[model samples]
Target: MFAIVRRHPANIAWIALNVALLIVVAGLLVAGSRVSVTGYYSEAAWNWMAGQSMYDTTGTGFLYLPHSAIAYIPFAVQAHPQGDVAWRIISLILFVLGCYRFFRLSPQKSEFFNLSAGFVALLLCADCMRNGQATVIMTATMLLAIDAIRRENWHLCTWLLMLGFAVKPLSIVLILLVGALYAPMRWRLGVGIIVLALVPFAFQSPDYVWQQYEEFGLCLFHSNRIGYEKWWAQLFGMLKAFGLEVPDSIQTASRLLCAVGTLAICFVLKQKLDSKRFLVWLYTLTAIYLMLFNPRTENCTYCVLGPALGLFYAEALCGRRWFAAGSMMALAVVILGSFELGQHITPQGVPPVWLAPLACCFFTLYAAFRLTSELNRLEPPPSREAQPVLE
Candidate 1:
């Protein structure tokens, strides 16, 4: 079935055209002067350059690592409206760079599949740019890290992963995922990331850096109450939103279930850790885990799932028919969940129903189940025909 897609180059071009149209339509929807989460980063950089404490900034707290504030200084120096536009443009570039890196690492046999997968991913994540969030940059660094690992560039991978963690501490788990995949290189990766992370702060003010780190920790602890509802707060949040009572023990139950499930999956795929298929599966699962298990995940944060889904769909089309079907179902779940159609699921009565909580939760479990099943299958994946020699 997919051979027809591979034979025709025009299909790839059509996919590219649709991607451009989606971007244009979404851009029109968000073309106003609304200040997004990125405004806080820009404001923090300006404050830090003025010798004011980043933690003391009024609007949204400068919750990221001190290095992020230092890096944003260039964007901050730009005058008013231009800085905002420049930051968005830079972020969009980073997003495209990340997509390009992923394709380079996993060069598929079918351009149609690759281009279409990426188009679907971009369509799903257009809002990340609209909101001027940092997820796109963090996601791009993650792709770079994956590409570095594929090429066995240990130092570059460590540096990219550390930059991601510096931008958003939740990405520390992704660092751990990298360690698990390349166990032998873990020590070198760990040391390089930590050293690079601290250099910016050490050069500035050691005492002030210490203070800001402490404040950052405290801010994270209380972030759930900051008013804006997270898109992926998991089962407990969903249950509470549906007006069901949740006990303190629900937290313990949730952790135990996740731990048990993770262990079972490891047991099943324990022998395939070194295979290319396992690597792709692990990458997708890790990204999905970040979305599902994080304490606070906004709609913008879900953009990280883009590459993961694209990888899954591309692989599935390469002869794993069941896997391909599962990937399409997961994609549908993601889009349905994104519609904000179930706001009645919230404690406060709001309009624009948001089903993300339910849909994301279902899709997360579904992907894990499908991955485990794929790992346990006895037959090897299908092989492709080699390209013919030119006459």
Candidate 2:
């Protein structure tokens, strides 16, 4: 027994730590209905069976589209008469599993980071009001696609991306566009995956689906061209600093800029995407793009907090002491200005929605602020890649 213990010390230690964290998490969640989607998701779900509505479209001086309509599906799945307590509990559980899967899907088995990643996933369940699981589903799909493409398994990649696009249209652009940087051959597969995503759902209402395609343009124009003041205030402020409106043209341009920047990072900066570190950057870009450019990112939508927060917290596991100290200071500002920390999570910084994203950009040194610029300056990641696998 002594010899066995000596041989598997890290293994034993990690198991013990995971148990403690799991217990603490279960205790916190079960204490009460503290972290919930509130009534919003149920309402959206109920509205779906009620009228097949999309995204809080009830009291709208605005139009509703079925494109964002799937928010109601899980609620419909749970189908509690009260549509309140029992149903949300189920969605919350799914949200947890989704996060767990996302973290597990990461290439590294670093317990420090994996468990930290799991905690961040739990944070998604704890804070956000909108379909918290939606982002989970999206992350899962994107990660699966990344996995498939890395192995050059286009068949598997297509199926995974199809599920992602079916869940939410946002993945249609992010997964496909950003994916082309490393795996340009896979872009055609991406478009095919998107086309296939509609087949089964197409049977539901092909014309409505096509109409949603048309609405995509309107959605872009509405959010980009006609600005709404929400959490993205700082991000939009930066765009204004550039003397531009958030027009469809600018929306197109931003994506092009992100794409060009990504390519430049790969070619010019010589950043390589074939390493384990690639997903870190991929997810980072998707999250930041949402925060910076998405028309709205409410406090409830704090579900995306997992990837950024996970990367942020994992820095302590990194070998940077002073850098970690500075990150802690910056993280303090993020918590104070962004999250509600009353033992239960609430989104506090409505006026400063960009705070979380900006914090993510600042705090995650390995990816956003440092890498995009660094990668742009180098050759390509694979050639300069010092190790075959990046830690």
Candidate 3:
């Protein structure tokens, strides 16, 4: 192990940094610092274990499906501080492994690229880790799922995607989008969803499970209704920052159109790009959409974009695309420094909520241009017979 570490010094340093962070976060938790949203998750799990309702009307209420609470049971059962620290450790390990796998997906890799991109991604998502947000696991699962797709491991892909959904229902966007566009995933995803939905029934009484499902639906509906009435750190907030107060009807219409448009783009790219490129692009597009369009998107939610940005940055550097590398670096810095930058530009340093959406907009436009250029350069396949079989 020491010899291997000496051979890959940069990777070892990255690993060391993650270990240091884990220790710092653990110490903070033990010191009674309220650094995580794990309390809400623990409360929901406790409520479920007590055969009580997990849903509430508060802003910080548990908004995930019934299975999510069940999934949190392991951590929830552990005592405070220790439980929180353990959750963070597991999350960080998964996140680091996921990022490493994503970096491997690149056509070329080097010590500099790995170290630089890894550090940048960690910096971009540090707050989310510190806050013990489930988004960290969601992001990690999504990265792993994409890697699974690249390898055509359908079963693993299905399981990883389902795990992400079980952690945060918001992952349904990626689930449905990928299922619809990837032919091999369609049936596997169908089975996975069915199994996931039924798993709770085995753990609880049928009536209780059904009742929780109903409450889950109601909770989602209430959250959506509230999401519309309030401005979140998404596209609408970005627009509001620019003094463009779009009407609710228009916002609703725009969301529908954009969702459809995203599917359309993915469909086209599926036919033209290789499986690996397609999967990577698919993940990037999904992450951007979630940040830009998800109704309840918060500043910490921007962590979803960290893996994709890190991969892109590394790819740009390897390919000698300085402009792309700079753009990605700037976006990551903007997101990581949004609080400090906002103080000078916005009132009371209210961490410009618009910064993330703005970065997503630029990324989307650039990605579109790059995709269009690549598509135009490729010769059309003969009779669609040359396409690789994903299964």
| Best candidate, lDDT | 3
Candidate 3 structure quality by residue, lDDT tens digits, 1-391:
2321455888788878888888888888888898678888999889888888888744347888787788888999998877888888888878887887777766666777777778877876788888999988988999899888888899999999999999998788889898898789999999999999999988888888889888888888878877776767789978877778888898889888888999998998888888777877888889888988888888788888888888887778778999999998898888887656765787552437777778878878877877788788886665855768798
lDDT of each: 0.63, 0.49, 0.83
What are the per-residue Cα lDDT tens digits for candidate 1 across 135-173? 778888887787777777888888888888777776776
Instruction: Report how far residue 71 has shifted in candidate 3, in Å.
Output: 1.7
- TM-score per candidate, in order? 0.78, 0.63, 0.91
Q: What lDDT would candidate 1 get against the real structure?
A: 0.63
Which has the better TM-score: candidate 1, or candidate 2?
1
Candidate 2 lDDT, 1-391, residue by residue in tens: 1221233545355345444544454454455444544344445444444544333222222222343345455545653433333333444544444444445445545545555555544454343422333555555566556556556676676767666665655575555554565565466665775566465364356555565445544655555444443224335533443344465566667766865665455443324544445655566566656655555554444455454455544544443555764564455345344644321442343233445545545554545555655456655455554658768
Clashing pairs in 1: 340-353, 340-354, 341-353, 341-354, 342-353, 342-354, 343-353, 343-354
Error of 3 at 134 (Å): 0.7
Decreasing lDDT order of the candidates: 3, 1, 2
